[model samples]
Target: MNDNSKVLVALLAGVAAGAALGILFAPERGTETRDKLNDALKNLGDTIKDRAAEEIDNLSSLKEKIVENIKTTLGAAEDAADQAKTSATEPA
Candidate 1:
């Protein structure tokens, strides 16, 4: 994974840990505590899914741009070669 992804994962882990610890320590009934923790976990999961989707889209866009640049470069080279060949064949 990239540095940005690593950092994001670490930050998320820290947040999850903190939330769990905080909920565990709060003076509340067992059912209430479990419910709160469950909600927190669900929210975290949704955030992770959203971030993953965004990253995938970003990567796809980058890939497309790279492919386009390569194609353009190759096309320019081919055109230059064709011009050079035509110039060589012309009478003086």
Candidate 2:
């Protein structure tokens, strides 16, 4: 896990803890409080899922870019080698 991901996880944890504490301490009926807490948790879960999907997509794109770059580099190297060989074989 990168630093950014670790920081994000820590931030999310703090927010969830703070939200839960706030909701528990607020002056409200028990049923309503429970309902609100449930809703908040569900929303947090959805947000995490969405973020996870975005991260997966980003990683996939990075992987594709790395693969493309490697291919390009290898192709260039091969072309350079072929040119060197052809020049060396030519009568001088």
Candidate 3:
């Protein structure tokens, strides 16, 4: 997977572990702990979704830039070749 996905996965895992520990040590009722854990998980999911979208957008932009650079370099090479051909065919 992409970097963003990896980071998101790591973050979610950490959050889940932390929540589990919190619930274990919390003095509150079992129902309250469960609710907090659920909220945390839902929020983490939303955050990951948003970040992944942004990362995809960035990757697309980078790809476009790379394609453009390649086209420019090819154009320059073609121009140089044309100039060399013309010079060689001219009277010396």
Candidate 4:
């Protein structure tokens, strides 16, 4: 996985731990607590989705850069082969 993936995982783990602790220490009755937790979860889910979209964009850009570099290197190699072939076939 990439750096963004690692960071995202760590952030999600921290949020889950914090949510668990909030539930353990909550002061309200069942329904109220459930409602509050549900709201919090919805908000957190939205934030997570936004961050995940950004990470996906970063990953896509990284992939493009890698592919471009490969193409450039391959082109250089092909040119070198063509030069070598021409030298071999020409008069000394």
Candidate 5:
């Protein structure tokens, strides 16, 4: 996989290991540990969702810029073509 994927995998593995260790050494009861795990998972999920949304917004913005560039290039080409046609049809 790519570097980003590798890093993400490593980070997830580290988080899992750390959580396991924390649970093992926790001073609280099972219910408290479970609650903590649940909260951690919910937070992780929210973070991933936010990142995805941000990436989507960035991609959308890039797409709009590309489209605007294409339109401007096409308009320039059309203008040039019109000028060439007018010159060709007129006296030298």
Candidate 6:
């Protein structure tokens, strides 16, 4: 993975850890604390899923752009080669 992806994963992990610890330490009933923790975990899971989808879309877009550039470059090269061939065959 890239640096940005690594950083995002690290940040999310830290946030999850911090939230779990904070909830565990709060002076509340056990059931309430457990419920809060469960909600926090669900939220984190949703966030990760959303980020994964976004990353997949970004990668797909990048792949398309790269393919287009390669096709354009190949076409230009072929055109140049054809022009050279025509010029070489023509009479002076």
Pick the lDDT winner.
6
Question: How does each model score on TM-score?
Answer: 0.91, 0.88, 0.74, 0.73, 0.78, 0.88
- After TM-score superposition, what is the CA distance of residue 68 in candidate 1 from its true location, in Å? 1.0
Best by TM-score: 1
What's model 3's overall lDDT? 0.87
Minimal lDDT window, size 10, model 4: 16-25
Off by over 4 Å in 2: none
Better candidate number, 3 or 5, judged by TM-score: 5
Better of 2 and 6 by lDDT: 6
lDDT of 2: 0.93
The C-alpha stretches of model 5 lying farther than 4 A from their native spots are 1-13
Local accuracy of candidate 5 as per-residue lDDT tens digits, 1-92: 55875787578768866886797689999898888888877876776678668778988999999999999999999999999999999998
lDDT of each: 0.98, 0.93, 0.87, 0.86, 0.83, 0.99
Query: Which pairs of residues clash in candidate 1, taking residues 3 or more apart in a chain or in different chains?
Result: none
* Model 6 poorest 10 in a row by lDDT: 1-10
Supply the TM-score for candidate 5: 0.78
- Give per-residue lDDT, candidate 1, residue 45: 100
lDDT tens digits by residue: candidate 3, 42-67: 88778878977988899999999999
TM-score of 4: 0.73
lDDT (Cα, tens digit) per residue for candidate 4, span 1-92: 77867887798879967986697588878888778778778878888899879878988999999999999999999999999999999998
**Model 3: residues with Cα > 4 Å off, grouped in runs:** 1-11
Score candidate 3 by TM-score against the native: 0.74
Misplaced by over 4 Å in model 6 are none
Q: Between candidates 1 and 4, name the one with more favorable TM-score.
A: 1
How do the residues 1-92 of candidate 6 rate in per-residue lDDT, one tens digit apiece?
99999999999999999999999999999999999999999999999999999999999999999999999999999999999999999999
Which pairs of residues collide in candidate 6?
none
| Candidate that beats the other on TM-score, 4 or 5, i.e. the better one | 5
Tell me each candidate's RMSD, in Å, in order: 1.1, 1.4, 2.8, 2.6, 2.6, 1.3
